[model samples]
Target: MHNLYIPVIAILAAFAIIFGGQAISDSRVDDEIKSLISKQLGVDGEIELQAMKEVQKGYGVCGQYQVADQGQRFVPFYYSKVNERVTLDADAERYRRHCGS
Candidate 1:
């Protein structure tokens, strides 16, 4: 029926908006993570972002980075959206001590 179709369309539209918003949020956070890492390591290129997940304040990002032929290194970082800061480590001692990991 026409009324049934309306509800279906509304549900689909809601889903689209929710998913689209989340994707845009993730992309922005990922870009921020890359910039923070670049600044911290003093390198602009060779950053390979592998994974990212939402955390309490911001996100937990993991990636591989190569610095001036030093070979690729696996790194994890925590970016705090609330404080607008980044730290090295997301689930380790150092991060726990500093940012509750």
Candidate 2:
């Protein structure tokens, strides 16, 4: 009985580790997407990347850009991890135009 319990615990632990690693990988991907979007927009300021809690409605990452001259603005950019692509929305285009991107 004890041997059976140990195997089950090991399997559960392995699953936990795999899931945790995947979560961390997803987070890093989100951060990289935010960084790429910021660079593309020519944003030279403080930037914060946050994951959207609801994946269906919003971009994978939401970027908060704090400009020295114009305060701050929220930018949304789409990120597809499987495809490794990032894109800005129409509103983001307006933001780039306004911020002199």
Whose TM-score is greatest here? 1
Model 2: how far residue 5 lies from native, Å: 3.4
Error of 1 at 72 (Å): 1.3
lDDT of 1 by residue, 1-101 (tens): 88899999999999999999989988887778677778887876756566455555343433333343456666666666765567765566645654443
Instruction: Please report how far candidate 1 places residue 33 from its true position, in Å.
Output: 0.5
Backbone clashes in model 1, listed as residue pairs? none
- The TM-score of predicted model 1 comes to 0.71
lDDT of 2 by residue, 1-101 (tens): 77799989999999999999989976787567657766877876555554343243443333333334555565555554545555567365533442223
TM-scores for the candidates: 0.71, 0.56
Candidate 1 residue spans exceeding 4 A from truth? 57-70, 89-94, 98-101
Cand. 2 Cα-lDDT:
0.57
